[model samples]
Target chain A: MIASVGNVLVWMVWVGAATACLASGIAVVTLTNPFFSALGLIGNLSSLAVLYLLASAEFVAAAQVLVYAGAVMVMFLFVIAYLGGRADAPWAGGSKLFRIAAVVTGGALLAETLVALLWKSSRLSHSAAVGPTFGSPAEIGRSFLTDHLLAFEVTSIVLLVAAIGGVVLGIQPSPEEETTA
Target chain B: MSALFLAATTEPWWISLIKAAIIINIVLVTFAYLTLAERKIMGRMQLRYGPNRAGPFGLLQPIADLVKLVRKESFFPAAAIDVLYIFSPFIAAFAALSTFSVIPWGPGWHIGGYYVTGYVANVPIALILIFAVGSIGIYGFIVGGWSSDSKYALLGSMRTCAQLVSYEVSLALSVLGVVIMSRSLSLVDIVDRQYHEWWYLPYAVPQFVGFVVFMLAGTAETARAPFDLPEAEQELVAGYHTEYGGMRFGLFTMAEYINLITLSGLAVTLFLGGWHIPGPWLQAYGPIWFLLKLGALIFVFIWMRATLPRLRYDQLMRFGWKVLLPVATLNAVITAIVVVAV
Candidate 1:
């Protein structure tokens, strides 16, 4: 009876988080204000983090909030605030053809997701059993060092290159400034 | 009387709820008195009596302040975004309050036939969880400033955003040394490792560099004096919450103090061997020791505020990125190498 109650609670949480994720994801694109859109994105990321916690991937869940919802979104808010009145609404002036293309692409992705969900649900009645240390930091660190070593190194290099690119872009003289110089 | 000891994971849900209730109240009371203490201490430093009129030695100051704040008219700026302007303080307070949940206040003890852990929740990634919740707290300042529709508020939030983001890197990096030595991210495990180590010394000795960087970065992260560029009063007129009044403003203040308390608690847990006394005979009074250490760290925070002048904006940025970040990174690297070798 206790196990059944626990299962019911877990299901309730999963459903609530999933619904919030979808709602916020839609809100991100639908919101007129840039700040609101960013807020929506944060909401979406946070709800997704909740889902990750529900899945018992505690490290990934925390990283999702720390890196994306926290650091990256703050930067986005910073830029939006800096731009202030000049920041235009997303896709506000896009061509009709572009909007159509975006819709088509979104529809395709949604269909693919639905199909995959159905396929997976048919194959497995419950989530696959994970080992005791499956999502622990130590296990994750070991996996990154051994099984995913190359991928990990590549990711670091990519991040380094991105940082350099950002610095270069930031230092570049604007067109008007260059002409004067 | 039967007694049963339970691990953090095995404890029942109601027990966790009880722990949460107790912790929240304790933290809130501490926060209320901390404001009073800060004022009194600062007043003493500057050669003035602070709030002596309120309930003898200003014991009732916090209560009086609460009453005034609650009763005051909550003035909203005409151009402010209503939804976010109102929601931002709660967001900030929520982040600050939740970060305390994972902080283990003491070693677990059996009480009345039940084993109760020190913390509300003992997740595997408790350390990262604190940072994650803290990051969310940044949004409160940012959103509050933006929603207020004031340039001063906007600039304040911008400064807050940049300062916090820059300092967080060094702050997280500085703790890597401790995580390496302990080989676990859980606060309880870290404290346990410190207690059980052969030398009986906290990580503060071996990872002194990390400890210094952690404290410096923590000061910046909490936006206290010397690093409080975001709310530099002369420049920004109270910064992000310039337009906020009444309880709305009070919430922001509450969040800041709570975050300060949480940071001190974390420092004690990470560097000072939380709740661990040198002698085995004093083990039963673990919570008292924990509180004593936590209070000392908080006093240091207030002392720093009284002592140091605020840093210049450019100096703040330069110090965080150039000096603190490099020192933290280098310390982490050296610690990792030494750990691997020995």
Candidate 2:
């Protein structure tokens, strides 16, 4: 009886969190104010973290908050705040042709997702029901270090290169720009 | 008798709720006293009396401050984002308090047939959850600043966002060393790992550099004195919450104290052997030992606040990214190598 109750409660929590997540995602696009949009993004990210928890992907959920909602979103807010009035700049700068192309590209991506969903219904519905040991940090660490070692190393290299590139590009100005100024 | 009844019931959800309430109340009361403690300690450090007038050595000072703040008028800017401006401080306080849910205060206690752990939630990623919730707190400052419609507030928020993001890197990397050593992410498991070792063999010995980096990054992350460039009184006037008044400002202050306590708690748990008393005699009183360790770490926090001067903006950024990050990364790499080899 207690086990059934616990399972029901978990499902209820999952439903509530997933709904909030979707609502926040909608708010992110619908909110005209850049700051509000960013706020919506935070809400979406956090609720998604809650959903991750419900799914028992505890480490991934925490990382979702730490890296995406926390650090990355803060940077987005920082830039929005720094730019101030410019954050609300109109999309008129983009040509009509460019806007049309963007819309078409978005629609194509949406259609592709829909087609994939319909084609792989059974596999998609499985929800990746992992075993008891699957989402544990130690398990993830072992798999990363051994089974996916190349991908892990490559990711680190990519991040390192990106960091160095950012530092180089940010610190020293181009000679042409310096001379022009 | 209550424990006996509870044991027979097998009602974890209700018991967890009760535990949550107890923990929250304890934390809130402690937060109130912490402000008083900081003032008194800081006053002594600076050679002055601090708030001695309010009910016997300022014991009632936090209460008095709360009353005053509650009675004061809440004023909002004319052209501000009203909803968000109103919402930010509550978010800050909420985020700060929620970080405690996963933090194990001591070993599990068995009363009658019921078993109870110190923490509300004992997820596998307890440490990372602390970091995750802590990161969300930056939004409170950002939203509060952006919505304030003041130049100083905007600038302060921008600085806070940058500083927090930069330091969070070092903070997370520093913890990687501890995670490598403990081989588990649960706070309780980490503490248990320290039980077999003597006092000095605390992860601090192997990850001394990480500890230092964690402390530095934590200080910066919390926006305490020395790393308090976000709300520098000399320049930003009150920083992000400059336009806030009354209970709103009080909430921000309350959140700051809670964050301070959380950091101190983390430091104690990760590096200071948590609730494990050194000698055999005191081993049974795990929760008491845990509180003592937490108090000592909090004192170090207050001591640093009283002594250290705020770092310059440029210097703060440079230290976080250029120095702390690399050092933490190196510490993690070395610890991983050694742990693997062993």
Candidate 3:
């Protein structure tokens, strides 16, 4: 009885989270308020965090909550606040084109989901045999060090460029803006 | 409701709920007091008296402050983004509190002769899940800043995003040294690795480097001292929190402390063997010893905040990528060699 009740509650939270995520996705695109748009993104992101914990990816889950939700969101909020008083450039009338594009994209997404559902049986048998690589952090580490070494190398280059870019962007126009004004 | 009650009636269920509540309370209280201790310690270091008047050397200051905050009027900004603004605090608090769930609090506290291990989940990827939670938590800041409708708040949010993303790379890489050396991500298994040959000393030189880098980056990720450009008072005027007041402000402060606790705990776990008490013949009370170790770790964070100056924004960026990033990658490479060669 206890197990059954616990299971039910867990399922409820899972389903509720999925619904919230869907709602957030809709709200992000539909909302006029930039504030509401960011908020919706938070909801979607946080649900993904819970889903990580549920899936037994504990380290990734915690990292998700900390880096993405905790830290990145804070930065996103800063941009919103810093730009708060500034009005956005007026929207041009490509929304009808956007609607037509949305229809094409939406139809494609629907067709993809439908195909995914139809392909479930064939895909099930064809799924790659995952090794006993789940629990071992060392395996993940080795993978990072070996097979993903090129990616690792590129990650360093990206970070180096990003650091330089950040400093450059952070610079205030070489005192040129100040002199002109 | 009654269904919950019905589930609560199971013998083990009753104990489980009790244990959960106790753990949760312990984590929350630790967070609350750590802030006061940090403030007081930093105050003394800065040649000023901290909050020493409230109760017997200001120990009760957190409690007193909590009461005042609770009574204060929560001023919701009129132009606020509604849903996310109202509940971002809860989300922040929840994420901080949940990170403790996988922690092996104590070696299976005995109950009725069936050795009950004191952990909520013993998954293989507990460490990864912990990191994942941190990732999700970034949204709270973004949401809070946007919802506030303040320029300062938004700028702080953007800084937070950039800081966390940069620092997280170094932070994650630094830990690869330990994970490779120890061969497990499970905190339990990591502790077991320490039993025979201590991880700290064998890879002492590299581990220390990793530890320092992780601490520096982690502190920035948590928006703490030295890397607190996001919330720099003179600059952004409280950064993302420029608009919050009362308990809403209180919640943000509470979240900071919680983040501090989580970072310290992670440090202790990864570099310090978490709750694995040092010294032999004292392993029985390893749990108590572990708490003491964590306490000591938290104390040092406070000490650093008191002593160090905040980093310049450019310097902060440089330190992470130029210095820490390459060193961390080197540590990972060396660790892989050591593991494979062995």
DockQ values per model: 0.51, 0.47, 0.33
lDDT values for all models: 0.89, 0.83, 0.72
lDDT of 1 by residue, B63-169 (tens): 99999999999989999989999999999999999899888877788888999877787767889989999999999999999999999999999999999999999
Instruction: Output the better candidate (1/3) by DockQ.
Output: 1
Which residue pairs in candidate 2 collide?
A: none
Interface RMSD of every predicted model, in angstroms: 7.6, 7.7, 8.0
Cα lDDT of model 3 by residue, A6-125, tens digit:
669767877887888789889877766565566677767777866654454444555566666555665565565556523554334376888899899999999998888887858754
Q: Could you list the chain B TM-scores for each candidate?
A: 0.96, 0.94, 0.91
For each of the candidates, what fraction of the native contacts does it recover? 0.63, 0.67, 0.57
Weakest ten-residue segment in model 2 chain B by summed lDDT? B1-10
Lowest lDDT sum, 10 consecutive residues, model 1 chain B, at B1-10
Candidate 1 CAPRI assessment class: medium
- Give the docking tier of candidate 2: acceptable
lDDT of 3 at B82: 66
Interface RMSD of 1: 7.6
Residue-level lDDT tens digits of model 2 in B88-170: 99999999998887677776788778887766776667788788888888778888888988998888888888888888888
How good is the docking of model 3, by CAPRI class? acceptable
